[model samples]
Target: MSLKSVSAKIFAKIVVLRIQKWANNPIETQQKVFKQLISEAKNTVFGKDHDFENISSFENFAKQVPVRDYEELKPYVDRMVSGEKDILWPGKPLYFAKTSGTTSGAKFIPLTKESMPYHIEAARNAILCYINETGNAAFVDGKMIFLQGSPEMQEKNGIKTGRLSGIVAHYVPAYLQKNRLPSLETNCIEDWETKVDAIVEETKNQDMTVISGIPSWVQMYFEKLQKSTGHKVGDLFKNFNLFIYGGVNFEPYRAKFENLIGRKVDSIELFPASEGFFAFQDSQKEKGMLLLLNSGIFYEFIEATTFFDENPKRLTIGEVKTEVNYVMLISTNAGLWAYNLGDTVQFISTKPYRVIVSGRIKHFISAFGEHVIGKEVEEAMHKAISAFNFSITEFTVAPQITTSEGELPYHEWLVEFDNTPENLQKVAEYLDSEMQRQNSYYLDLIVGKVLQPLKIISLKKNSFQEFMKSQGKLGGQNKVPRLSNDRKIADALVKI
Candidate 1:
């Protein structure tokens, strides 16, 4: 049926408010909305055993809730692995969007029916914002492809059901719902290559109007697209209109995509979790992304610096400050309250609360007093790769400084690319320049002897996914966790 009118109205109605909400709202308005959400969240889960006595008792109550890893929620998480039905949601959940954990074993985060409306709304808001700003709905007018894992959902009775890829197909825009291209499934849970052959078989020669999914998988998708056809990357997607991507940093793979499509991709970011979709790029051309303000759940941010504190404190929607980086904290209907999602981001401006992802708190590098985080690495890479425009297919950095008589550890990078000349030295030189530009402390430390120069090593073809697969962490939602901060990934990257 025609959600065109509904879609048009939804997208149009929020244009001004979304812009205002993302950029610079009145402080009082922000606080009022924040407080209302807090009250709504409390009221939403009041009888569900999430006890928050009052706002004053929140600090201590926050401490009382255990800091949980995915494994801690294994039982509930299993239900979400892949399937249509689970206790995680109120109604039957439409799909099981698979994401990996520390290892692949089971980071199966369930998307609950109780919470999918928010995801749909956020996605709508992003599309609407883009249309209002750039009039780019032509991106949606074409055949959209979501490069996700299998349609598998874990069941309470211990069997996975529905393809994760299948579930998303069911829930996306109805106009495109019937036109979803066939997905590469069956082995989505096994590892990466299982879907490689399938990715190629399906994507080849297809007119992909809009493509969205994890960055790594997207890279792999087109790489195989190039290999299978014996042509360059652009040959596979010449008809591509727009590319929407998320779940990992798009910097590394962007160049490759440009080469393959032979065009400047119109990209948008989506911030959805296994639990639910949160926010996305509202306008096609804006510094800040629009916040899905009234989506199913309420969102809040904790100061990034304070997130790792022993007694980490959380700022309410009204109380949280902006512009600085903050770890994402969500109050979702999916059995999580004040949940620390581990990812971090920065506020571009808050009138409309547009934010740019900084990086993950746990995925940080602390070699030799250089607390290098994902955002630092991403910004450095974004600037350094400006000339080459070479999409970084896969990359990881190991922190080690040359210890000459107690020398500190430095960063050693391993990158995979599809290019003619593989000049490691040139890549390293530019990386050093970027490091100096992005982080003054890092530059000062390099001069003062805490770290050494950066190193870039290119990997053989198809090595990245092989490395991820071997570790049982390869799939749609999972990526090659760029800043490993350890030797495990280095060993894995080199071996692959």
Candidate 2:
């Protein structure tokens, strides 16, 4: 916050712009850059010192590296936490970012001081872009919010054990640090009740320049705030800065936030995980998020869906199908290689390489976005529909559309239930509100009443068995996936 520090950051911002300008075409830029990083990763994995003067040397080393997953990095975590300095990046590491995916259990990825500089750079670049794009940086004069994980990290043998958020928080700019809002979930001490009781009073009047965290928590918190005080957030704060978040999309909960303040706000993206901050929106355009490849990690793009009779193929940055979905693979400075990130993405543009989140590749419904992931749909619908002394024990959602026809105009939501009203017309209105309250795109794409209403599936006992039998994943890790690609489940849910 000092003049010297501020001036230095301004200089760094200019350098980033110059570098970004040179990478005009993201496809070519990624291909050339990735090949270099890939080469360095290979050498690093095999025990080699990096010649930091020129990054190209690391690129050369990546060629000899072998692909690895999280399980393969256990030895490094143990050694690094033990204070050994020869692991992934040189020097003592601060903390590991905590993340959990489909294949890997909750993994705390190690972060060294050398790599931390880049992590800060990549994330800060995005923040700068948000400021430049919206011209809304003036709000920073107020307070900003980050709905981060807990501020606690476990320590072992004088070294901290656990994810990087706590460690990263320690390193954040001290002035900015003063404005961070604590998490309602993780910041708890059973024996210390006074601290828990104090957060509400402390946070009640903080100059929150930025509000960031999980969308679900963000939505739930604001609702709680309103219900508790009977006064909206706008009445409390005259100028709320920005909402920076990760882990999930904010489109679903946009309505609630915008409605609360009576003004629309732009939300920024943060893709950091236990792995690392891979990419962030470029702070140049309306949604100019860019991939930070040269930082501590390199990336690989894999085919998301192969034809029924075709083989799976790995695509490079150039080969990524525009507008098609892909499974992301990571090779990070923390010693993780070729690890598949369960989320899916769609490339919207190649110049400056842009992407739109399609949905979870592992989480799908008949290949449609409607394939609701997690138990939210059942929970939301149950709360909305079961007011008349009725409740839902089990339910499922599937997309049923005439794929065989020309550009099927609409998709239908098939819902199964027992002991419900015969008239299912209200299904569309109620579920739509819940879905829209959750994702903004769902509201945008499925607007108007063209799509089929929520077709209630009144099920008989043991009927869900037939449903489970149809998916082949029943009783397994896959479990009858809550969302499906076809509407067969909804079609049958209406029958009983």
Candidate 3:
């Protein structure tokens, strides 16, 4: 083995040991982070306004700080954006992660010096943990590619600002620089399709071992490679063995990926965002991600079922239970206080606090009180495809509340198939049955005659890509919502 490969294996062991210390003491580690965040920012503008000086415990902190989303927190953020110091954190942030927002044009999530390292380190540790568990560090010697936004950044009031992926691009460690690809010039291409084409040309003959990106976008890259070389991805890049992905469930896309690659490969799922790097898959045998407790972020959970209640109960890490959906809230070292991240998660294991991102709080279909979530829809789709031995390229679900004639409103599944089923109606009925089985409220609605069985609409090739392009979000961390409450997405798909 090369010297670097040997060193990586040794270093991976050390990192895993350090992580185990906190992973085994989840609550205590979180408490220390909570105290440290409060102590460090006690003199900042937000800390003083929220009375952080007298706050002694989780209860005290919770009582003093109310949960705020991006819109609610904009007043304080505006001051920071205007070049004010200590408005939220102890000093000016090193960077602002620019992300698209629904109401606002864009959101600038501050990344302070203290909190930024955790984001970079968490990503590194995920791979190290895998190496420690499986004794495979050989990929470290081969080429790696993370399909991301351009590293080109803009300066806003003296702070560097860009998309989170682009901002992260600047922080790739020196050790990986030699192995990382598409060349800096190609990565800076503004158009995603053009960028992927450049990437294909740049790395077509290299010994690529690690390919990472959002699954949907990476699928597009793989398709382009196959079209160019007329070979499966595995044949073109024989060493490509690890696939790292985030931002969506991988199960729904697994069959399609295996088909494209011509073989099965190990994969890692990450739960990262502009707000914070929360969790990552730590075990190949496990179902969920290891929640980071000592990462300079204090977490609170409000049960998703009771999230809209007047004054719902807020629970700390110690109080969270497995299998219950909760809206994740965080008070971070980056100056966000009791911030609502909007993503809902369910704990798969609480022994060391591992969770799976279930869905976004606002991204659900509750038009008829059925309250179906992203996880339900994704799981239902996966089950249906598996049962019928079919494969799909992409899909999204939305409710059609206004139907013609006397029929009840129903969910419309817009699916792009790689392998069509022999019986479309039978597959749709199976999908509907699976959905009803997963959600009791949905079952109740179906039984009570309030809604009809879901209808599947077959979409042409590249429909989702066209839709994304129409919205000016074709690639670079963009993804189609798995489920929406209304027909906005469904209508667009039909029109396309």
TM-score of each: 0.81, 0.66, 0.99
Mind giving the per-residue lDDT tens digits that candidate 2 earns over 92-125?
5566665543355556677665567776776677
Kindly report which residue stretches of model 1 are placed more than 4 angstroms away from their true locations once superposed. Answer: 1-99, 103-105, 108-110, 139-141, 158-166, 183-194, 230-238, 321-323, 388-391, 401-408, 420-423
Segments of candidate 2 deviating more than 4 angstroms: 1-16, 25-93, 100-105, 181-198, 283-288, 307-311, 366-496
lDDT digits (tens) for residues 151-243 of candidate 3: 899998999998888888888999899999988999899999999999999988899999999999999999999999999999998989999
Q: Cα deviation in Å at residue 288, candidate 2?
A: 6.7
Error of 3 at 68 (Å): 0.5
Q: Give the TM-score (vs. native) of candidate 2.
A: 0.66
Sort the predicted structures by lDDT, highest score first.
3, 1, 2
- What are the per-model C-alpha RMSD values against the true structure? 4.7, 9.9, 0.8
Candidate 1 lDDT tens digits, 83-170:
3342433434334444545654535554555565666666656666666666545555445677766654455434434444445645
- Report the number of backbone clashes for model 3: 0
Of 1 and 2, the candidate ahead on TM-score is 1
lDDT of 2: 0.54
